[model samples]
Target: MATFFGEVVSVYSRAVEEDEEEEEEGEEDAEIRREVQKQREVHLNWRSEIAESIESSSDKTFQCSDLVIAVGQNASGFLSAFVLSTGNWDVVGTVTLWNERTKGPSQVTNTQLPEESRCVLYRQAACPSVVICQCTYYVAEDQLFQWTEKVLGSIQRRGLRVLVLSDCSVAEYKTSECITASPSPFLRTLKTSEYRDALRCPLMEQPNILTGLPAAVLSHCQVHRIPAVVYQCYSDVACPDSLTMEAYRPALSCLSSKLGKVDYNPSTEVLRKVVRVSEAQSNLYT
Candidate 1:
């Protein structure tokens, strides 16, 4: 009878131990669920905060002051130092560089940098900014000269201080902002459709000096008053103002030299128009 009693006691003990283990497991499961809930809340809050920031940023306005950009095929970007130098700008814009690979080549409307070359160019160039790409339609467009005129006319309407820089400035640039260290007088014209579009012009069967393509482009810039500056790739090569691959810079110094030093700041009110950012990109974590 005692042995039988001992067996019954052992069975009861085993049952109690099993029940304890199950309770412990249940508690562990509850703890895990709590942690998961906390993490989910955290992620949601983070997203909401980011969205709000982006939304509000669009309300910010550019107060078009002065702009300096490093124009290039691959490393095209606005220098941050230039931004700081020309702080409280009314507007800023950066072109999609030709050389860098686009990070998200699919999304088109949000950013305008090229698919093959995307270098956070606009991040530093934020403010009443628009992206232009030569690679996109330069090769496909017909009536290139006509199209270029339209684009430049549009840029002129914006009314901002525009300064273009070469791979390196060979001459000093004079502007409201700091002077360019190595100004390339050859690189003076704004990026326009005149030359690229003229290449497609049928007057010449091939691209050469004889086509009078250079004369046509020169006349276009002169009419538009867009200062054209060409760049030389290397020191060994002479900088040719006429070429397919080229750069552009400002000629404020030349203007001053011709007309004598005149501080345009007193008349700066002409470019003081302020424009707010679009509603969409304000809070984005650029």
Candidate 2:
């Protein structure tokens, strides 16, 4: 009878121990769930803050007094410096355009920089150093000329001196096909005497001038008097307007002092005026 009692006590003790272990495990699971929930909340809050910041930034205004614009190609560093230099000053619509590669070579847009040769040539007109790599480019002559006119026109409109740097290899250019093609745009735009002068400028006389893409670009710039310089694979080429990081902060401070902030006024006011006039005419007819 005593042995039977001892066996019952042992079984009861084991049951109690198992129950406690289960309880401990349940608590640990609950703690783990809490941690996961906390992390999720933090992540969501961070995302919300980022979204709000973006929305606020879009409507932000800045002072536009005493604006100094700098234009260039492949000069992200310079552009950033310029921005930092003019802190609190309105820098809306700065940094005109850079050569952005489209999805594929075959995809041509109205403003797509034509052949790789023409692309570098365009940059050379604006920037001092241009690097050309050997690559196949497909663009029609007329489109290329038209795009060139637009780019040059932008420079004239902005009244900004631009320096560009292109970094590509000399071996990449395909020049023979481009050289023989008629530059009819030049013929149309240039006066007879000016066209004669441009033709005399090294490009026509030099054999395989198109093969040396930088030389061709400089020759063209020479004809137009656009103040261009070309350098091959070298950053040592001096740009007087190179903005240093140290000077950037001070420049911004100066700009802030000179130009107070102003709100961006859209041309929608003109449309509003037109609508009001139309409404008045309709009321008179009524």
TM-score for all models, in order of appearance: 0.27, 0.25
lDDT of each: 0.30, 0.30
For residues 1-286, could you state the per-residue lDDT of candidate 1 as single tens digits? 2464564356677789999999999999999988644332200011233234444654322322322233332112112221222324221122221112222222223223233332222322343342222111111122335423432333332333333333322222334433344233223232343223111111211221211222333445556654432222211122212221222212334223322332333222221111011111123575
Summing lDDT over every window of 10 consecutive residues in candidate 2, give the lowest-scoring window.
184-193
Candidate 1: deviation at residue 274, Å?
A: 33
Candidate 1 RMSD to the real structure: 21.3
Total backbone clashes of model 2?
A: 18
Per-residue alpha-carbon lDDT of candidate 2 for residues 161-211, written as tens digits (9 for 90 to 100): 222222222233234666236321111111112222121111232232222
Candidate 2: where are CA atoms >4 Å away?
A: 1-143, 157-162, 170-220, 232-286
lDDT of 2: 0.30
**What TM-score does candidate 1 get on C-alpha atoms?**
0.27
